[model samples]
Target: MSVRTATESDLEAWVALRLLLWPDTSPDTHRAEAAAVLAAPEATAFLEKAEDGSMRAFAEAALRHDHVNGCETSPVAFLEGIFVRAEDRGRGHGARLLAAVRDWARGRGCAELASDAHLSNVGSRAFHAALGFDETEHVVFFRMPL
Candidate 1:
C-alpha cells in the first residue's frame, strides 16, 4: 500500500514483471537494460509494495527529448512500461502509480505525458484510455539489418 522509487534490491521482482510484459527479451538483457534505466537521471522507476513487503506493481517512465509518437512537446514524459499482477488489478494501483509519475513529469517541467500499447493489446489500450490517455495514431514499426 505504499509507492516508492525502485532500487537495485528490487531487481529480481522487477525483472520478473518485465519478463511477463515482454516475453521476448532474455533475462540477461533485461537485467542490463534495467540497470541502465535505473542509473539514468532522465528516467525513473516506481514500485508499489504490499503490506507484507513484496512488490505489488511497478512503472517506468522517462523524459524523451527525441521525437515521441503522439507528442507535441520536446522532453515529454513517456511511460515506458507499467504492470500490476493479475491479482492486484482493479484496485486503483495503476491509477495511483500513474498519477505519481505524471506529477514527476510535471516536476521535470514536461508539458505532456505519453504512452503506447501493442496494437493487438486491447486490454492495455483500454487501460490507458481509462487512465485518460488518448489514442493518437496507429503505426507498425520495421527494422532491417544493415
Candidate 2:
C-alpha cells in the first residue's frame, strides 16, 4: 500500500471514499471541498492506495486555529474525516492513513491532533480509543430558527 497526499489525479477516487463518510453530500459538493482542501495550506487529504491503483482508505484534515475540545494549542490538527472500506478494516490501513495525517500536521508545527465522532456512533468512538485517543468531552447541540 502506498500512502500519499492526494493530487488532482486522485480527486475522483478520493471523493468517492469521502462520500462514504458523508453520504448525503453531492459529488459536486465534495468536488468543491476537495478543491479547497488541495488549495489550502492548512488542509490536505491523504490517500492509501493498493497496488492496483485503487484507494483503500483516505483521511482529510485541516489546521484549526480556533479552540477545539481537548486541544491546548492554536492551529490544532483537526481530523475532518476518515473512511476505510469495511472490507479493508483491521488491516492497519486506517492507522497508516492517520499516521500520514499526523506527519502532515507535525510538519506544520502543530502540537496535537483532534477529532470527533457522532455521539451515538459507538464503533467510531471505539475506533478512536483503539487509536490511542482519549475521551475528552461531549455535548449535544441545540438549534433554534431565528
Candidate 3:
C-alpha cells in the first residue's frame, strides 16, 4: 500500500471515503469543508491506498493555536479524524494513515499530536491506546445560544 498527502484534486474522492467511513455527514458539507481545509497551509489530509489502487484509509490533521492537552506548543497538531474501511481495519492501513499525519506534523515542527473520541466509542479508545496515547481528562460540554 502507498500513502500520500491529499490534494484539491482528490476532494471528491476524499469526501466520498469520509462519508462511507463515518456515515454521519452530508456529502455536500464534507466537500465544502474538505476544500477549505485542503486550501489551508497548516492543515493536511492523507490517504492510504491498496496496491490495487483502492483507498483503504484516510486521516486529516490541523494546527491549533489554542492550548491542547499533552501538547507543548501553541500550534498543536490535532488529528481531526481517521478511518480505515472496516474490511481493511486489521491490515495496518489505519496505522499507515496515522504515520503519515505524524510525519506531516513533525515536518511542520509541531510539538505533539492530539486526538479526541466520543466518550462511548470503545473502538476508538482502544485504537488510541494501541497507538500509545494516554487517557486524559474528560469533560461534559455545553453550548449556549446567543
Candidate 4:
C-alpha cells in the first residue's frame, strides 16, 4: 500500500472513508467538511491506497491553537479521525498514515500530538495505546438546555 496527501481528486474516496468512520454524519456534511479541510492551511488528510489504486483508508488531522487535553503545547497536532476498512485492518496502513501525520506535524513545528476517542470505544483505546500514546485523562461532558 502507498500513502500520500489527499487532494481534490481524492475528495470522494476521502468522504466515503470519513462516513465509515463517522457514520452518524450525512454525506453532504462530510463533503462540505472534507472540502473545508482540504482548503484549510492548518489541517490536512492522508490517503492509503492499495496496489490496484483503490483507497483503503484515510486519516485527518489539524493544528489546534487552542488547548488540547493532555498537551502542554499551544499548537498541538490533533488527530481528528482515522479509519481503515474492516478488511484492511492489521496490515499497518493505519500506522503508515499516522507516521505521515507525525511527519507533517513535526514539519509544522508542533511539539505534541493528541487524539481522543469515545469512552466506550475499547478498540480505539487499544489502538491509541499500541501506537505509543499515553493515557492522559478521561473526561465526561455534561450539558443543560438553557
Which candidate number would show the highest TM-score if scored against the true structure?
4
Q: Residue 27 lDDT in model 1?
A: 91
Task: Name the regions of candidate 1 deviating beyond 4 angstroms.
Answer: 143-146
Estimate TM-scores for all models.
Answer: 0.94, 0.97, 0.92, 0.98
lDDT of 1 by residue, 14-42 (tens): 88888888899999988988898899999
lDDT of 2 at 72: 85
- Ranking of candidates on lDDT, top first: 4, 1, 2, 3
Q: Which portions of model 2 show Cα errors greater than 4 Å?
A: none
lDDT of model 1, residue 13: 85
* lDDT winner: 4
**Once model 4 is optimally superposed onto the true structure by TM-score, how far is the C-alpha of residue 97 displaced, in angstroms?**
0.4
lDDT of 4 at 127: 89
Clashes of each: 0, 0, 0, 0
Considering only N, C-alpha and C atoms within 3 Å, which residue pairs clash in candidate 1?
A: none
Q: Supply candidate 4's per-residue lDDT for 53.
A: 83
The true-versus-predicted C-alpha distance at residue 24 of model 1, in Å, is: 1.6
lDDT of 3 by residue, 23-121 (tens): 898999899888978889899899887778777788989999988876677788898988888888878787888888888889988868899999999
Candidate 1: C-alpha lDDT: 0.92
